[model samples]
Structures are given as C-alpha cells and as structure tokens.
Target: MRHIERQIVQLKEKILRVGTLVEEAISKSITALINRDSALAQRVMASDEEIDRMEVEVEEECLKILALYQPVAADLRLVVAALKINNDLERIGDLAKNIAKRVAQLAGEGPIDLPAEIRTMATLAQEMVRQSLDAVVNGDTALARQVREEDDAVDDARQRVRRMVLQGIKVEPERVECLLRVNSVSKHIERIADMATNIAEDVIYMVEGDIVRHRSSDY
Candidate 1:
C-alpha cells in the first residue's frame, strides 16, 4: 500500500480503538448502575480521561493527514468521517460517564429496581453504538442506515421509562428523588443513542456520499 493508504488504514484502526473503548464504557456503566457497583462506576469515570486523550490524538492525526496528503475521493470521505465519528465517540464516552455519575449517586439507594423500559433503552442504545462502529469497519451503508433507524426504538424505550418513572413518583412521593435519578439515567441513555445515530449518519455519509437530512433531530 501507498503511504497515504497506510495512514488511512492506521486511522481507521485508531478510530475503532476509540469506538471499542466507548462501547465497553457504555456497557460497564449500565452494569454498574444496575448492580450498584460503585467501584466499577469509578473505573468508567477514570477511563473518560483516557477517552478524551484519544479523541484529541485522533483529531490531530486527521488534521495531519489533510495537511500532508490532501486525500481525495474515498480517502477524503474517510478522513472527514473520522473527524466527525471521533467527536461523536468522545461524546458517547461522556454520556457513559454521566450514567456512571448517576449510578454512583444511586448506589446507596438500596436495591434499586430500574423499570424494564429503562433497561431496554440502555440495551438498545448500547447496540446502536456497537453497530454504528461495525458499519464503519465494514463500510456498510445499509448497516449504518439500520443503526440510524434503530434510534427510534431507543427513544420509544425512553418515553416508556419516563412515564413509568413519572407515574411511580406520583404514587410514592417520598421516593420522588430516587425515581428522578432513574429518569436522569434514562435521559442520558437516550442522548447516547443520539450520539450513536450521529456516528451512523457519518458512516452513511462516508460510504454513500449522501448527506442525511436534519442530521441532529430525532424523528
């Protein structure tokens, strides 16, 4: 392979490294939350700093490639997508950290029972991120689109959990504070879904050269 192609390959590998880290962080955050594992939650939070560092390094590498190689065609798309996906992955890591923060607060609440919907929402959101990264690896626009479409399932799960929490708070006003934390975790998961959608959108853009409309809004 030529020098530029080699760099592109390295770039994809680096991006995938970050993708995998954020994905595991998301999973561990949910596990810590459900299990009330404060030690594991602290692990997730500590890893965020490393994730942040990786994000910066990826951005710098992309800039270096653009300045040095002036990549064209698919190479340009890959570089651009790398930049966008890097940002999205970093945000996903932050969202996972946010979930960890909430989980740490709820650790002492004693045997918290998250609604089924909340668990489903978290599961779906994590899958979205995982599949989005897969799409990037395979350059599969169809898979990327599927990941984007799955965002709604996560959102639906979120709405259901929100209603469940709200209703629970209405009946047991004394537990309102705890229920509110559940609601906050649900919101964090939904936002993570949004970030996954963003990564899928970028993957589609990378593969098809087609710009997905209203890239930010959830429909």
Candidate 2:
C-alpha cells in the first residue's frame, strides 16, 4: 500500500480505539449509577484522561497526514472526517466523565429509583456509539443512517425521564436534589447519543461523499 493509504488506515484505527474507550466509559458510568458504585464511577472518571490523550494523538496524526501527504478528493475527505469524528468522540468522553461525577454525587443517596425510561435512553446511546464506530470501521453508510434514526428514540426517552423526575419531585420534595441529579444524567446521556449521531453523519460523508449534517431527518 501507498504511504498515504497506510496513514489513512492508521487514522481509522486510532478513531476506532478512541470510540472503544468512549463506549466503555459510557457503559461503566451507567453501571456505576445503577449500582451506586462510587468506586466504579471514580474508575470511569480516571479513564477520561486516557481518552483525552488518545484524542490529541489522533488529531496530531491527522494533521501530520494532511501536511505530509496533501491528499486530494476522497483522501482529503477521509482525513477531515477523521478529525471531526475525533472531536465528537472526545466530547462523548467528557460527557461520560460528567455522568461519572454525577454518579459519585448521588452515591449514598438512599437508593434512589432510576426511571425505566432513563435506562432505555442510556442503552440506546450506548448502541449508537457502537453502531457508529462499526460504520466507520466497515464503511457502512446504512449502519450509520440506522444510528442516526436511533437518536430520536433516545431523545424521546430523555423526555420521558424528565417527566418522571418532575413528577417524583412533586411527590417527594426532599428528593428534589436527587431527582435533579438524575435529570442531569439523562441529559448527559442524550447529549452523548447526539454526538454519536454526528459521528455517524461524518462517516456517511466520508464513505458516500454526501453531506448529511443538519439533515438528520433526511436519512
């Protein structure tokens, strides 16, 4: 293979590695929240630094490829898409860290009940990340589009979680703080799902040379 081709493959692998880390963080954060395991939450928070380091490394590799190869057309698009996807993956990592922090705050809060809708939202978000990364690795636009469609389900679940939290707050005023933390957790998960959708869109652009940003519904 040519040098530029080799660099592109390396870049793709780097993005996949970052995606794997983010996915694990999201899963662990949810597990921490559900199990009220502060130790697990701390572990997730600590992993964020590794994610940040990988993000920087992937970005530098992309820049180096661009500077040295000066690839045109499809090659250039792939590099640009990798850069954008790297940013999105890093943001997802941050969201996971935020969830871990919230989980720590809610620890020992007397086993607060998590709304089923929030659990569903978290599951969907995790799936999105997995599917988005699969799309990137396999160049599967169809899988990417499917991930985009799943984003709406996550949003709906988020709304349901919010409603449940508000109702809980009305019934048990003392649990207001706990419910607010739950609300924030749901919001963070929803944001993570949104970022996954963005990554899927970037994958589509890279593979098909189509612009799907701001056209989520058009998929």
Query: What C-alpha lDDT values do all the predictions have?
Result: 0.90, 0.92
Estimate TM-scores for all models.
0.96, 0.98
Off by over 4 Å in 1: 215-219
Per-residue C-alpha lDDT of model 1 across residues 1-219, encoded as one tens digit per residue: 999989988999999999999999999999998888899999999999999999999999999999999999889998999999999999999999999998878876766678878778888998988899999989988888888789888888888888889889889898887999999999999999999888888888898887895865342
Which candidate should be chosen as best, given lDDT against the real structure? 2
Question: What RMSD does each model have against the real structure?
Answer: 1.9, 0.9
**How many residue pairs clash (N, CA or C atoms closer than 3 angstroms) in each of the candidate models, in the order given?**
0, 0
lDDT of 1: 0.90
Q: How far is candidate 2 from the true structure (C-alpha RMSD, Å)?
A: 0.9
